[model samples]
Target: MVDNRVNPTSNMKLLLYNQVDGRCPFCGKNLHYVKNQIQTLLEIAHIYPANPKSHEAELLKDVPRLSEDVNSMENLIVACRDCHKKFDHPRTAEDYYRWYDLKKELMLNDEAKSAFFDNNVEEDIIKVMDSLLKIECESDLVQLSLSALKLDEKINKENSFIFRKKIRDQVVDYYPMVREQFNELDAISPYQFEKIATQVKGCYLTLIKINENQEAVFRMLVAWLDEKTGKISSLACEIIISFFIQNCEVFS
Candidate 1:
C-alpha cells in the first residue's frame, strides 16, 4: 500500500537533511542533497511509512502503538536517491535502524566540532569587545593576536601529559612567542585579559612579533568561521564574553 500522497514541507525537508548530515545514512552519499545543491536529490525516508497497512509496517509491528507518530522528526531521515529506494524496500527496517544510530553519534561529534571550529564564537567575541570597549577592531583578531598564547594553555589542560608536551611543541613552533608569559589569556573576563595582556605582556610580549605561522593560525580561524555552520547563539556569545570576563590565569 504505497500511498503516494506523502508531501513534506520545504522546511521539514531541510531540517531532515541537516539532521542526517546531508547524506544517505546507509550509503552515506551526499549526491545532489548538498546544502547548496541546485536541485534536491534527497527523499524523505520514513521509518514508519504513512500507511500503517503498507508492507513496511509489517516490520514495525514491534513498535508501540502510542509511540507512533508517522510525521515526527524521529521517524524520518533523509536519503539519497538510490538509498531511498533501498530503504523503501520491504525487510530493510533493521539495517536502516543501525545507520540511524550511527547518524546520531556522528551528529553529536559534528556538534562538538562546530563548537570548536565552525561556530563563530571568536568573531562574536570580537564584535562584543569592540562594542563594549567602544574601540574599533584592529588588525589583531581574537584568533590573530592573543589566542596564540591561549592555545597552548587550552591544549595543555585538555591533553594528557605526553600529549600535552607534543601539542605545546607544535604551538611554540607555530606562534613562537618570546616567552610563555601570556598563558592566562582566557583565564578570566575579556576586560581583565585585556588589562593583563596590554598592561603586562604588552611590554615584553610585544617585543616578539607575530610570525607568518601565527598569521596563518589567524587565517585558519577566520576560514573556519566562514566555512562552518553559522555563528553560535546569543547565549553562547554571552558565555564567551563571561568566560573572557571571569577567567583568570596566573602565568602572567
Candidate 2:
C-alpha cells in the first residue's frame, strides 16, 4: 500500500484546488457562513474514501489522481455548511443513489460527471471494462477457439463443449454489440484473423495504458535493489534504468 500522508506535486495541487477563500466548490458558499469560525470552516472532502472498509459508512473513496495525503488540496473539495451537514449522517444505499441522480441532473458539469462515475464504479472497475474490451476485439479465431477449448478441458474434460458454451455466453452477455462484430469475422480467413488480432491488441493497450502501476512497481524494485550490494546488484539496477528509458522511447 502507498503511504497516505505526503502531498502530491505542488503543480498538481494548484490545478485541482481553488486559490481564493476555498469555499464550497459547487456554489462558492462561504467557508465561515454562520459564525465565520475557522475549525467549523470547510473541510477537504476526499473524493474517494481511502479506507474501503469504512467507505460504506462514510461514502467516500480514494481518488487515484489525488495525492497520497487524503486531505491535500487535490483531494479536498470545500462543501458549504448545508451540504456538509447533510453528509454527516450516512444515507441509505437507495437514498445515496437517488441523491446522486438528482445532483447529476442539476449539475451536468465535468466535475459532477466525474464524481458520479467515481462513486458508482467505486472499485477499480476500469480494469474490468478494459478486459471486456479486449475480449470483444480479439481475433485469431482458430487460436482463440483452441485456447478456449483447452481451458474448458482443464476445468471439465467430460463437458468441454458445455464449458466452451459457458465462456461464449459470458462474452455475449458482457458485450452484446461486440458479439455481432465477432460473428462477422467468422466469414474471414484464419490468417486474416491472426493479423487483425495483433493489431487489436496493440490498439487496446494504447487506449488504457496502466503507466502509474508500472512506475510504482519499478520504484519498489529500485528500493529493494538499494538495500542489497555487489557488482551484479549494481548491474541489475542499470538494466532496470535502461528498461525505463526504452519504455519512454515510444513517446520520442
Candidate 3:
C-alpha cells in the first residue's frame, strides 16, 4: 500500500509547535534541544491515522475524529519522536481519545490567545476601574441579594463551584457601583457607556466562537480586559467583566 503521509509545511510546523508551547503534548519534553546547536526533536503526528492498516482502521472506526482530512491542523499535534512512534504503532481507542482531547484543548487555547491580538476594548473601561478602586467607604458599595444575581443563570454547569462563588462575590460586591459608573458615564457623555458595552460584547462574541465553555470565556474576558487596561488590576478587571455579565453584555 502506498504511504499517504506528507510533510507539513514550515508554517504549519511552526504553528503546531506554538500550539503546544514548544513542548511535546504527550510527554511534556521540549520539542527542541540546543546541544551544540538547535536540534529539533519534534514530530507532527496525526490524530487520525493517515494510512492505517485494516486492524488500525477497525480499532478507531467508531471513534470521533478531529478532521476528516488526515493532515489538517485539527488532526495534527507536535509530539516527541518517542511518543509519535508509540502513538502510531499501537494506537488504541483510549489513546486516540486522549490525543484528540489534548489537541482540541490546545486549539482552543491558541484561539483564545489569538483573540488578544485581534480585539481591543474601549479605553473608557479604565475610568470604571478607577471608580471601583476609589470606593474607600464600605457603605459606598450596594450589594445585591444572591437571588438577584445574574451569574446563576448565565454560568454553565461545566464551570467550577469555586469560580461560580468567586464571580458571585465579585458581582454582589461591584455590580451596583459598576452600573452606577456606567450610568454616570452615560449622563456625562451620551453613548460612552454603550460604546464600552458594545466593545465588551464584541470581545465576548469572539471568545464564544473560539470556545463556548463559560469558565474559559469568563477567564479570557478578564484577561483581555486586564491587557486592555495595561495590566493594572486583575480584581478590577474581574469586577468589570462580572458587571458586563450582569448587564447582559456577555454570557447571555
Candidate 4:
C-alpha cells in the first residue's frame, strides 16, 4: 500500500521523480502510476508560483508552512493528479513528503552523495561570506549591495553606483589581496548550509527596511534586474504598500 501522507501538487511530481523513490506519493500509484511500467509517472510543480503576487513578505517570514519557505525540504512533495485540479499556482503540499523516505534511504549513489556534500559546503561558505560582507557594508545604504557584488563582473563601472559604491580606501583598496582571501576561504571552509535559510530570512527583513521609504530608488534598482529575477518578494511589496496606506500624510 502506498503511503497517503505526502501532498501531491504537480510540482511535487518533478521533485518525486528526481528526488523521491518508489510509489506515487499522492495516490497509491507507485509502479502502477508508471506508464507501460517502463517509465515512472511524475511531474514537478511550484505551489505558490501561480499566486506569487498574492504572497506577503511577512507571511513568508512567519509561516514556515507557506510555499515561500524556500529553506525547508518539506515545502515540496510528489503528486499524480495531472487532472485533479485545485489551486492553480501549486504552492501547498497537503500530503507531506514522508513517502520519499524509502528513496532517500535506498538510493546508494556514491558520486551523487559526494557532490551533494560538496555543494552543501560551498553554500555554507557563501552564506558566511555574505554575512561578513553585509556587516562590512551595512552603512553603504544600498539594499541589494551584496547581491550586486555577485554581479560585479557584469556591472558597468559607470552605472554601478546606483547600487554599490566603488571602494578605494584602506585595506579594502588592496583589491587583489581581498579577492585572494575570499577565494582561499571559499576553497578551504566547508559550507554550513543549515544556516543559509536563517540568513535568507534576515536578508528579506533588511530588504523590507531599505525599500520602505524609497520607492523611486527601489523601483529603479529593480529596473536593472532581469524580468525573471527582478521582482522582490511579494511579502516585501506588501509591506511597502501597507506603509504607504498607513502613512499617506508623509508622502503629501
Candidate 5:
C-alpha cells in the first residue's frame, strides 16, 4: 500500500511535543530518552485515523471526530510509540472515545492558557484571597442555607456532579463572608467591587468563547485567578468564583 501520511514539519513536531508537555498523554512517559545521547521517542498520532482500513472506517463511522480533516492540528496528538501502536490497532469505540476526550481536554487547556494573557483579573482581586487567609476564628466565616445556592440555576448540565457539589459546598461555606468583604471593599473605594467583578466577567467571557463547557470555564477561571493571586489556595479561588456566580457576574 502506498504511504500517504504527510510528515509533520519540524515546527509542527515541536508544537505537538510542547502541547503534551514533553510526555505521552496516554502513557505518561517522557517523549525523549537520554542515555548515551538524547533520542526522541515521540510519534505524532492522529486523533482520527488518517487512513482507516475498511473495518476501521466502519467502526469509527458513527464516532464523533475532532475534525473532518484528519491531518489538521486539531486531529493530531503526541504519543509514545507504544501507545500510538496500541491505539491504532484494534481501535475500539471505547478507545477512540477515550483518546478523543483526552485530545479535547488538551486543546481546551491550551486555549485557556492563551486566553489568560488577554483577559486577566486585577490585583485587587487578591484582597479577597487575603481576607480568606486572615480568618483566625471559625466565627469569622459565614454560612448560607443549601436552598439559597444558585449553582444549579447558573451551571449547565455539562458540569459534572462532583463539580456541582464542590461549588455548592464552597458557596454554602463562604458566600456571605465574601459578599461582605466585597461590600466593604466597595465602601472603602467606590466601584472597587464593580471593577474586580467586571474584570472577572471579562475573563469568563473570554474563556467561554474558547469553550462553552461550564466546568471547563470554571476550572480555567480558578486557575487564572490562582496565578494572578501569586498561587494562593485554590479553595479560595473556588470560593471567589462561586461568589461571582451568585452575583450574576458569571454564568449569567
Candidate 6:
C-alpha cells in the first residue's frame, strides 16, 4: 500500500478520495484516517501526467481538449503512495492502459452495488461514512459525507426504487426517513453526524479501557436492552452497538 503523505493544499485529493470511496482502488488498502498521529496515505494522482513537459502529457497534445483536462475530475484518481510513484515510472502507454483497467474495476463494482440492495445497507452506510471520517483533508467533510450517501443511492437504482418509495410514503417509521435523511444528509447533516461520532468515539475508547474483549463490550451494550423506557430505546441501543462492533477497527 502507498504510504506517502499528502499535501494539505489540494482539494483534488479529497475529491479523488470521494470518487473512489476513500481507499486505494487498486490494492483496496484503508487510506483515510487509519493512523493515529501520522498523516493519511491517500493522494491525488492524475492519470495523464499533469506536467506539460512530461512525455505522457505531451501525447495528449494532439488530442483536442483532453490535455487541458489533466487536472479535471475525470482525469484524477486517488492512489496510495506506492501506486502514485509506480504510476509515474516506466512504460507510460502500457501504464495508462493498466490504469484504465483499474479505473474500470473501481467504477464497476458489483459488491458495493449489491450490498445496497441486500440486507447490509446499514453496514454499507457505515463503511462509506467511516471512509469519510478517515479522509485527511478536513475541508468539506460534510459535503463529502453527503456525496457518499448520494453515491450509494445511485447504486442499485432499480432495487432501491420500491424501498425508496416506501420510505417516501412512510413518515412515522424511521425506516424510510433514516435512508432518506442519510441520502440527503438533511435531517442530521454531516456536521451533526460528526458531533455524534465524536461523542460515541469517546465512549468507544472508554469501553476499550474497561474491557478490550468483544464479550465485555456486548454486555455493556446489552445494558440498554433492559431499559424500562421503551422498545424504541432498546432498538436504538442495539443499532448503535451493532455499528460500533462492526466498525471497531475504523478507530484503531
Per-candidate count of clashing residue pairs (backbone under 3 Å): 11, 5, 0, 24, 0, 3
TM-score result, candidate 3:
0.51
Instruction: Give Cα distance to truth, residue 192, candidate 3, Å.
Output: 14
Query: How would you order the candidates by lDDT, starting with the best?
Result: 3, 5, 6, 1, 2, 4
After TM-score superposition, what is the CA distance of residue 73 in candidate 5 from its true location, in Å? 46
What's model 5's overall lDDT?
0.85
Query: Which pairs clash in model 2?
Result: 48-61, 48-62, 49-60, 49-61, 49-62
lDDT of 4: 0.36
What are the TM-scores, per candidate, against the unseen true structure? 0.43, 0.24, 0.51, 0.24, 0.50, 0.35
RMSD of 1: 12.9
Q: Is candidate 4 or candidate 5 better by TM-score?
A: 5
| Tens digits of lDDT, candidate 5, 1-252 | 755477788988888888999999998999898989999999999977888888998988899889887888888999999999999887888999999999999999988666444333355577878888898987987788877777778887767788888888888888998988888878887877876787789889999999989888999999988887888688889889999998899999
Task: For model 1, give the 10-residue run with minimal summed lDDT.
Answer: 243-252
Report lDDT per candidate: 0.46, 0.39, 0.86, 0.36, 0.85, 0.50
lDDT of 2 at 183: 38
Q: Find the candidate with the highest TM-score and give its number.
A: 3
Indicate the worst ten consecutive residues by lDDT in candidate 2. Answer: 243-252
lDDT of candidate 6 over 91-197, digit per residue (tens): 36667767766665655563445433342333334433344334466352232132222223322344345543432222222222233334454243444444434
User: What is the Cα-based lDDT of residue 107 in candidate 6?
Assistant: 51
Per-residue accuracy of model 4 over 132-217 as CA lDDT, tens digit each: 34444435322322332232342235444533333212112223333343455556653332232233333334554665434443
Candidate 5: TM-score? 0.50
Q: Please, what are the lDDT tens digits per residue for candidate 2 over residues 1-252?
A: 554544456554434334323556556666654455544455544443334345564443321233455555544444665664565445345434443343343334546445433422212222223333455343522222333222322223443465346534433333333333433443442333233333333423453265423334334444433343222343334233222222231111
Give candidate 4's error at residue 123 in angstroms.
Answer: 18
Better of 1 and 4 by TM-score: 1
Enumerate residue pairs that collide in model 5.
Answer: none
